[model samples]
Target: MRYGIVGTGMMGGEHIRNIRLLDDVSITAIADPVESSLDWAAQSLGDQQPARFRSAEELAEKGEVDAVIVASPNFTHRAVLEPLFDRGLAILCEKPLATTIADADWIVERAARNPAPFWTGMEYRYMPPVARFIADVHGGRIGALKMLSMREHRFPFLVKVGDWNRFSRNSGGTMVEKCCHFFDLMRLIVGAEAERVYCSGGIDVNHLDERYDGETPDILDNSYTVVDFANGVRAMLDLCMFADGAEHQEEIAAVGDAARLDVLVPPGDLVFSPRVGFGAPKQVVREHVAVDDMAMEAGSHHGATFYQHAAFARAVRGEGPVEVTAEDGRRAVLIGAAAEISAREKRAVEMRELDTTG
Candidate 1:
């Protein structure tokens, strides 16, 4: 399948690399507002040269590709979606479908109206360890999951090409921008929608002194949120941006009435064995699955990003189903957006109260 890549930033570059590894999938075109970015792509893409465009509109007008991979910033998803609407193009858009519920609904409406092959980049579900966790949870390895938690202890946010990520309006608040992966997986694993959220965090030490000439520093560097699910299962997120180069970048696990599961993704290997107990604490036992050498990270999802693209490619080729449907992406945004609201208003925000639905 021929692909047109929008936004030649870090994500765009990573997608290009993973796509090059696949058979019958090739990068035919690339689009970005910055000319320097296209130059970077030209040098980075080695032997394969793709047609360059200044915008998604230009690429869409050309109509030369079979699919479009949108790796642009969060707020620009709607702009990218506009020109491609009704074109019956297969699209794999990045997460937080849009910065706002209204915009997310707009994308959903068009998908419902025209019915094309479309999906979002909630790539965590495709991770071998994460998928295993979900399977183990539902397969009764961890009988009746009660609570889930995820922690991301990493360095400060990476600098974007345009610095648009510094402001809330442009990046849809940092949680929606960064933590939506965990949020989406939380929902999928627990098998329920988030009923409410309570978040406490601010631009505390990491980027507190940062400022542009005109823009305010609104993105938070740390956030702690407790999301209550409709099924009475609870999930929590502990995000700290100042602890870069710490022991591990991410740690996630779930606890059930009968047993528990944990995952840790370091740089070189995904060393995480599921320890489940059928009875008391003394009966805890470890599963003997061999560890996978994940020795790579594409935009911080670790080895899962490549798997995400593979799934998208399969779906685009009519060989598989679209797993990260539009609603899945929207619900994740809804939960993240609510977390933002909870932080701002200093109160628990009900998911249903927001102008969003999944």
Candidate 2:
């Protein structure tokens, strides 16, 4: 299958390398406005170099690829996507599908008319340990979920080719860019749509010196958001971008009436404990996932990224259903967008207050 990759940044470049590992899958074309990025991609592909286009639209118009893997910036998905929906091509679009509900709405509207084979790139679901935890919740291992929480203590954002990432406006705020993965997982594990969000945090550190001449410097470095699902469940997300060398890069826990599941990272694994407050004694079940010890520090061990791509490739080949739907992609963005607003205004934002339908 021929795969055209847009945006040869870190994530895009990762897809190019990992996808080529699959049999019969070829990196057919690449698109990125930055010449250096294109050069980086071309140099890596060597004799197997694919066709290059400066813009995604040009690649789409050229008709050289069977499927497209859109790892473009958060705000650029729609531009690359709107042109290809009616072409009946399969697409694996990266997160925050449109960066905002309005853009997401636009993409969905156009995408619906074509019945294109579409998949959202949400790699967290493919994480072995996280997937197991989700399965345990859905399988009734944790009855009637009540609360969920996740924490991400990692290094500052990776530098993008353009400094577009330093601005929340361009990157759709820090939550939309970084924490949407956790939000998506929370939604999946909770099995409900978020009805409201209350957030608090600030642009305390990280990019204080990043006063880009033409842009407003308003990106956040830390945040804590509480999400209330429509089903009466609650989830909290704590994000700290300055925790450079924390022992655990991420962690999560799900608490239900009957049991609880706790997950820890950098050796991401799970522990399930059944029978809480009512019982004095508890049985703890642990799922020990053999995660890479240096996954986070080395910043290159994204097994989930690889696994998710395999799933997308299968879907592109009409061999399976998309693991993450466009709606799922949009909802994740909506939650992040709302959380950002709530954080800024210091008020709870409801789904009704947002233009989710548009």
Question: In candidate 1, what are the lDDT values of residues 274-325, reduced to their tens digit?
Answer: 4434553454444432323441434456567778877888887788989898
Candidate 1, position 329, lDDT: 81
Off by over 4 Å in 2: 214-216, 276-282, 291-301, 356-358
Clashes of 1: 1
User: Relative to the true structure, how large is the alpha-carbon lDDT of every model?
Assistant: 0.81, 0.82
Candidate 2 on 1-358: residue-level lDDT in tens? 8889999988888787778667888887999999999999999888998899998888888848889888888888878887777566778888878777788888777766656578888988876677777888888887888999999899998888778788877889987888788889988988888898989989888877766785556888999999998899999999999999998788889988888988777677799888846647778887787643333222254467767777888877778887798888888888888889998999999977885373
Which runs of model 1 end up more than 4 angstroms from their true locations?
A: 267-300, 356-358
How many clashes in each candidate?
1, 0
Q: TM-scores for all candidates?
A: 0.92, 0.93
Q: Summing lDDT over every window of 10 consecutive residues in candidate 2, give the lowest-scoring window.
A: 292-301
After superposition of all CA atoms, the RMSD between model 2 and the true structure is 2.4
